[model samples]
Target: MTMIVRDFRPADAEAVAAARRSAFPYLVTTAETVTWEVAGAPAERQYRLLVAEVDGQVVGSSEIGVFHESEEPGLAFANTSVRTDTLGRGVGSALVTAAEEWLAGLGAAKIFAWTVEAPHAVTFAERRGYRRGRSSRVQRLDLTTAALPPLDPHGLPDGVELRTAADFLNDPRPLYEADVECTEDEPDDVPAGRLPYDQWITLTWEHPSLDRELTTVAVVDGTVAAYSVAHTDGRGSYWSGMTGTLRAFRGRGLAKLAKNDALHRARAAGCREAFTGNDGDNQPMLAINKWFGYEPAVTEWRYVRELAA
Candidate 1:
């Protein structure tokens, strides 16, 4: 059983997405998102999608790219996903090896990855010279059964208005500005700086999975004070990609309001399951998710390895 690792072709999107879902069922993945990631990544990121094939069938895949948006240089990441049924077939190792060689050739100083907190997964990463770091919680909410908060649009705070991402199609600069402010406050190992408007539009706002109708925003005096970005697979699965509020809007419960509205909209739109990730240290957001009846599905730890010069 020879395993061959090679660059990903557009035709491999479905297999790659299936492998990813098999490895981490809690996360939402679709072939369309996989194709968009590979085709729409910024050039400076040096993004490469690697696939592992056994007898012409894809069994694993890895998303490898530089942290081009981070102010810090030489930081890269390579996340490998192998089908659960093929766990011990060395497919993961082969994908990681190929990703490292390519990233090292590009002068990457450090590589980061996320692995499930299970014992076998932890050991696999450790044996590959990766060290454990921060962890995040993957949570799931059953949209069909959860008791979602009532959406009373007219009950918002004084002068605060509720809007959907679709309302900003004419001018999304406000949303981009809000995203920049909110992203800066997110807890992460890498410090990501502001992305150019054009890049944000290409990579985020215009993404195929982004459900503008379900993305709720809180506006205060005509300003985007908070928002919850929604992503859906068109298969009854929804993901809360990001939820944040501007600094000035803190303590107003705007983030909670926005996310609540988004979740409700998702349920009404035929989505059955919802998912979101929260950093272990982010108590506020974690509490918000808990309020929505989301249960802990899994924990994934960030792993890092210094590349040998």
Candidate 2:
């Protein structure tokens, strides 16, 4: 049967989400979040979502776009995923070809993609001229089975307080500021460029997957010092979107405090599974996850190819 690759339609949201979930089960994904991404993507991103159909059945999907926020010009990405059952049917190649053509048309000089560390997936990327780059590990915790570290509020600094993201619904600028500062220091192959407050509010703060009530924040002397952003699928699965402490608060264990509080709250809320990812070389963050009893689940490698200008 012939495979057809075309732009994703609104009606394909559910199929696309399902394909992504099958390919990357460690990450949180839903139809609502997929729709929001396509509809609200920044203009500069030039985002395009495409799907590969076989005999009228959607079996693969890809999200391709320039990294608009990157300080470096011409950096782009095309992440593709094929349903596990549909592998070896050419869907993966077709999706990647379509995405590469779309991104190259946008004057992209380099295109990056991620693939699970499985041999077949890595071989597929290698055969496409993509070179391996940095890697990250996905960790999972059985919230229902594992004993979470005890939270000792008394151990917090004298002027420190723990709060939820929902508490700042009326005023999230402080959280935004804290996010910007911590993001700047995150380990990444590509620079983590500055994100404006307005965009943060729209993309991160208002995202459908975010669970404001379960996200914990650490405040020191009335200043936002650290936070753990939580995302839940409302189906017993939870993800730590991000956990970081402001530069001034680093080494004080505030990040641990915030994440511990958030995780405790998540388990209490009946979330059975928890997931998070960290750069392979991010020792501090990896140590923190280890302390929380999260077990390594999967590893993914970033691959990049130069696009002829």
Candidate 3:
């Protein structure tokens, strides 16, 4: 079987989505979401999507782009996913090579990729000059049977109330502000400080996979203090898109309240599986997941490599 890599064409939506699902079962991917992602990419992101084919079948894919939202320039990302059955056929390497050169041309000073915790993944990165870094656990909860702990019933404390993302249909800047605050404090050591409301509107709220109804937000004094944006594929699978509280609202349990509301809505809507990922260093979020009865499903070690100057 001859394996080759190339750019994704419009007609390859179903095949590309299928390949991604086969390679990363933990994700919630749909043809429409994939198409929207490719078409709606911002110019500053330097985004380019690619696919690897073997005997005319797409066996792998890579979403390569700069983290334009990061405070620093030239930091890029190139995540490659290959169907498990098609591994060892050189598809991953080919995709990586193409992605690296493309990103380098965009003036990317450093490139980061995620490799599963398995030995082959480590070997692959090390041999390619990428060094390992902090890891994150991908967790799953069988919602049908998992028992959740008693939520803090302070009823939001004073003038705070909990609502779904749909409530922000008319104005999403509140959610954007909450997101910016929480993201700046997320586990990744790399600095990310972009908070332009217009940019947030374009990149997040307008995302195709976002299930606004399943997303929950905590509003206090007419301000979005925290939120948990949920992602769904119009399927039974659910993913925690982002769960964060504004710095001023951290210890008030707003994050828990928002996520609990999301999970409740998800379960009511027949979602069977729930998934979330957190950096190993983020003990607070890990504890929160534990309270929800989630367990480790998989792990991915972060890797970074510098190109020759």
Candidate 4:
């Protein structure tokens, strides 16, 4: 029963992705995304992807890194997932130990992680000195049979227009600006700061999973008012990475408008299922998701551990 934990290699992408999907099926994971994450991380973040092997077979994986873009310093994260068939073999514990050591060596003051809300999963973290915190729910919509809201582009407000991300291929600064505003206001445990345009371009705008044609934006007076970021695994499944409205556009129902349009586009593009995650306390977004016929698929509990300074 020899178990080993080591840094991820490009050749291990498929196996690592498979382990992740086994733990969280609602997520959009692929070999390309796995490889991109390790290669595209910002140097300041000190990111690393670790894989756990048992008897020469990859059975678990985790990503650990500093929260460089967060307003709060010394914050870091480690998310570990083990293949269900190999869970009791110490694979998870090995990965967690390796990740925590790596982050601590990098001078992180705290580490945040999450697990599906199950008794065994909860106990695993608690035993490792992690305390439970907030929870988020992953919702799923059956795109094949959902009663989606009809989109009437002509019926929009006088200054409003519906457009896709592809419409801004020449210059996406407007979308990036709107995203910065929308993201800052979202409820989260980590206080995320705006990413530089160049980092955003490489890490987000050009992500392998992002589907520009399926992402919808609400334009008001030539400016992006709201938008729905769409990501797909190219396997008939779509994920709403984010759906938000700018401060001035909150009450205008623009977020819903953008999200609905994105969903429609995703379905029309042959996707059969849609998924999204919302913080437990984000009632406004939760309500909107419910309106879209998204039902709770699973709840994930956040956990945190403090390291000695």
Clashing residue pairs in candidate 2, if any? none
Q: Give me the runs in candidate 3 sitting further than 4 Å from their true place.
A: 150-156
**How would you encode candidate 2's per-residue C-alpha lDDT over 1-309 as one tens digit per residue?**
978999888888889988998999977888898899899888888999999999998888999998889999999999999999999888999899989988888899999998999988999999999999999999999999988879884577789999999999999999999989888887786775888788898889999999999999999999999999999987798999999999898899999999999999999999999999998998999999999999999999999999773
Q: Give the winner by TM-score: 3 or 4.
A: 4
- Candidate 3 has its poorest 10 consecutive residues by lDDT at 148-157
lDDT of 4 by residue, 1-309 (tens): 888899998889999999999999999999999999999999998999999988888888999999999999999999999998887778888899989988899888899998999887999999999998899999999999999989874698889999999999999999999888878877888988888999999888989999999999999999899999999998898999999999988899999999999999999999999999999999999999999999999999999999973
**How close to the true structure is residue 29 of candidate 2, measured as C-alpha lDDT?**
86
lDDT of 3 by residue, 1-309 (tens): 787889988777878888788777889988888788888888877788899989998878899998887888778888888888888889999999999999888888889898788877789899999988889899999988877654567555788888888888998777777787788778784678766887677778898889999998888898888888899887789999889888887898788888888898888899999999999998989999988889998898889888754
Per-model lDDT:
0.93, 0.91, 0.85, 0.92
lDDT of 1 by residue, 262-303 (tens): 998999999999999999999999999998899998999999
Whose lDDT is greatest here?
A: 1
Full ranking by lDDT: 1, 4, 2, 3
Clashes of 4: 0
- Candidate 1 Cα lDDT to native: 0.93
Question: What TM-score, over all chains together, does every model reach?
Answer: 0.97, 0.97, 0.94, 0.97
State the displacement of the C-alpha of residue 77, model 4, in Å, after optimal TM-score superposition.
Answer: 0.7
